[model samples]
Target: MGKAKKFRGLKFKYKVDGINKQLTDKYQTIEEFLEAEFPKNNNPLSPTGDTKIYDVTWNTHKVSINKIVNTLSDLRKVLSVDCYVTNTDIRLEKIKPRELERKSTYSIEQIRELTKEVLFEEDKRNAKVELDGDIIKGNSQRYQTFFTKGIKCVCCGIEGKYFAKEKVYRDKSYHLNLYAVDENGKEVLMTKDHILPKSKGGQDHIDNYQTMCVNCNVAKGNNLED
Candidate 1:
């Protein structure tokens, strides 16, 4: 589904990583190693034994060098039936149409065709809309409560840099925001509360702490998913 890759040895010119590198580096038999991996939009290398290279979604940094080799060995197990290393990109094969016609399972292309049809009708669903009045008031109520309730982070008590416990909320208050009273007698200080956070189960109940200071609470957005 990502990019086209070539099967080694099927194409004489295309080279596997270590296997081809020795030839190119030691004997200078080839100018460079032909990168053969799944073709993503970024790479130009092809598996057809041609010299073109291509980009694949696999990020080299996130995976260790040994892990990369291990993954390649794993892929080699099913490379022939599941994927094709191409000269321009890796081409993966879908289930055969004849097999789909005879099977009870949903066809592989059904989602693709449905997505196309939905996209075509998107404008009809976007017909029209209207709204009235603006609501802005109870913005920072819960955030201010953490310090009010005197609760601290469960892991580390409020003593230092992991200051959630001392403050009962998260803040990189190395920089503090100053608030001056407005002409209308309103305090212009606006902050948010962090709800059930990534550190916790992330429940949205009142049990969840609110963080004030837009910058303070948002530092822990859904990023916990990472």
Candidate 2:
């Protein structure tokens, strides 16, 4: 028996005349495979509709909606295909780019002030610390250390700057942005990463934390350094 075919982590196996064949070889691209497996007519609801549900399947195997969406999203990053999942229906369309607006940069002091006003309550509830061997509610000591040492990506060594933008929705709220400037002076979002990922049994304590740029963190995923 031949090995099963894998597509974006999903396995597809097929048998023909008592012989197993790779199903992935039949399709030229992910877009082709998607169109062939999930035809447009299978979706009765309009593309614009809020609720459009379909039983996603490939041959006799039932595929989860999340798997399909994740596959499509992964493909979009590599391929030129622009698409969005509305429920189970994958709608292929040219996404209009939003206009770029010049965002105001804030000093570390200003950022501290804004964070206190916007996210202080939420952070206070979520953040915890161990005081004299007793776990207590407080801001993360690691975060405090990072702030004091200046926020910077440990991997790339890019210093992070803070910004806050007002939300446009009815209930207006502030959106805090933590961005790092690259060599080319381009701004990239900064993130807090686990030195040893939480999935690998790493604790959410001060010692296990590090600052990372979004791209580096995504590339790292759940991987541990050798």
Candidate 3:
């Protein structure tokens, strides 16, 4: 729920751009005018009517005067009166528990509590697992690979720094790794191939996996019968 604001204890300073006898006669000072227009306790102004004098015109060159000062000037300007006034300090009224009335709907707290109860009831339907806050050990296939075991490809003596994909396999089901040295003497990758066709119900499991250079894999792809 959004909070409603009540302003109080505002201190204002005012100056007129030009003299106007009609406004001057009604209120001699800006403070007096504000006090009369917004009486204590009756309006948003504080009952104490605290005020102080201070100079705020330090940087007139950089930016225009504060909005509060300009707004006061504009209000009087509309009535052919030119004035510069600013409220220095304003206190926000403390928020109290309030109920908005429409003569139909529930209060804010009632809606909030009901929403929380519904969410909790929905959460109870989810599966619950016992967590002792300790890391549990499990055998993941990712950890059993040559990449994890620090083993080089069976066909290539050196493990390449990159892995190349064989496109002739009809789909990118797996990657084959071969090794070669570039002119810079850096280990380069070759394509890995499945000894049996995966489309022919061949397993990508460990025992069936084989590494082949790109050239060999492409040659095999052309020679193998459909």
Candidate 4:
């Protein structure tokens, strides 16, 4: 080798002094600290509880709770608790980057079958449909299939996850509705868009239907696509 490569760029080095003291002083062992921090009832990390930590150091450090847990777990893998506690100059480094989006590994045929199953179920329940002149609307089940299978958006190409049996308050009553959770953790209502809008004399047919997120569909409005 001619020369050793020098690392260059905005390097992020986190000082563990404050966090180490906070963790070490609170509990004698790491196991004790973890147990107290992640309790079953009223836990911050739980779905119902507040996920965010209001610590000044943690906020400034720009590290997630999951990252901290993973770092400690990794340390426990090789070094003993005493060794890790004594090693005050411990550094967290990214050995491998994680994928941004969790995609479904389902095949094309599998997706088709899943979609068909949803449609069949909707038909069995006699799903309500709204008739507007010659245009029959409200085939929500068709679009719900995309959410059920975690399909990507046609416009933004963002993947969505099905959040089943969400209670919706409508007309002074609660009704369960199908919703999809997007990459940003936002709840998205899936909709079936007509390729050719009904306003432009588009027929209400299966061939003309396409799945779209509520946001994208609202943005598209009555604008015809080429």
Best by TM-score, which number? 2
Clashing pairs in 3: 176-191, 176-192, 177-192, 178-190
Question: Candidate 4, which ten residues in sequence have the lowest lDDT sum?
Answer: 5-14
Stretches > 4 Å off in candidate 3:
1-145, 148-158, 162-187, 222-226
Listed in order, each prediction's TM-score against the native is 0.19, 0.42, 0.22, 0.34
User: What tens-digit string does per-residue lDDT give for candidate 3 at 68-103?
Assistant: 323343433221222232222322233221211111
Over the stretch 125-144, how does candidate 2's per-residue lDDT look in tens digits?
A: 45443323333333433334
TM-score for candidate 2, please give it: 0.42
lDDT of 1 by residue, 89-149 (tens): 3333332212211112212133223233332232423321211121111122232343343
Q: What is the lDDT of residue 123 in candidate 2?
A: 48
Find the 10 residues in a row with the least total lDDT in model 1: 159-168
Top of the candidates by lDDT? 2
C-alpha positional error of residue 151 in candidate 4 after TM-score superposition, expressed in Å: 2.5
* lDDT sort, best first: 2, 4, 3, 1
**Candidate models: Cα lDDT each:** 0.26, 0.44, 0.32, 0.39
Question: What value does the lDDT take at residue 50 in candidate 4?
Answer: 29
